[model samples]
Target: MGWCSCINLFPPSCQLSELKSTMYERQKKLFDSCQRASKVVAYRLKTPPYKLDALEPYMSQRTLELHWGGHHRQYLEYLNRALGKNDILYGCTIDELVKVTYNNGSPLPEFNNAAQ
Candidate 1:
């Protein structure tokens, strides 16, 4: 019923609190979307911008070769393969797939990299 009680100028503190609340809500939604994107998004092979030999003084090319060329590449291959079978989950974000496969807190038998 006061000056700011619903129809007039809101106090600075009240306005600030409202602004913070709005930002928090928006940020939370964004975070959730990112999480969901992980599953739905196809695995992309990413390499460092610098040449493999550039960091050789500290980082070895062999390490990069194995990590990027072998492990990471392998992971993507399997993820794609798995996605191929499940039309529903394939399009769904990783977050959704994980939740569905989680079986209401109980994980499915297939721990084949999908769980990770």
Candidate 2:
């Protein structure tokens, strides 16, 4: 039974039941935090903020296509692949993964590019 549902069983001035309800709320918060900490967070690439035509005059449309659509897309693909091989590194926040795999100053070879 959830904490809120238990409220329906008690009268307004019931002190003992109210105390139990408060304890239930505290336990629920701790339980929820533990559950959330175990969840896997997936990483993804951000789409280009501006359209390909937005950077005209100086940069051409082809440059934008190859840079954003090609190179950046491939980097994200590599990151996903690197994450798949390491269970400890899987689902880590980007900053956490980078620091964890950095190996003091030098990085592990396979993940060095993907991490940075």
> Global lDDT for candidate 1?
0.61
Candidate 1 TM-score, C-alpha based:
0.46
What tens-digit string does per-residue lDDT give for candidate 1 at 48-105?
7888778776779998888878887787777777767644445555555555556556
Question: What TM-score, computed on C-alpha atoms, does each candidate reach?
Answer: 0.46, 0.57
Query: What is the overall TM-score of model 2 with all chains considered together?
Result: 0.57
- 62 in model 1: Cα distance from truth in Å? 1.2
Backbone clashes, each candidate:
3, 0
lDDT of 2 at 90: 60
lDDT of 1 at 79: 71
lDDT of 2 by residue, 1-116 (tens): 65544346656666887876765565344334442344455556677788887889888889988887788777777777776775555655565556545656656543464563
Worst 10 residues of 1 by lDDT: 30-39
**Inter-residue clash pairs, candidate 1:** 39-94, 40-93, 40-94
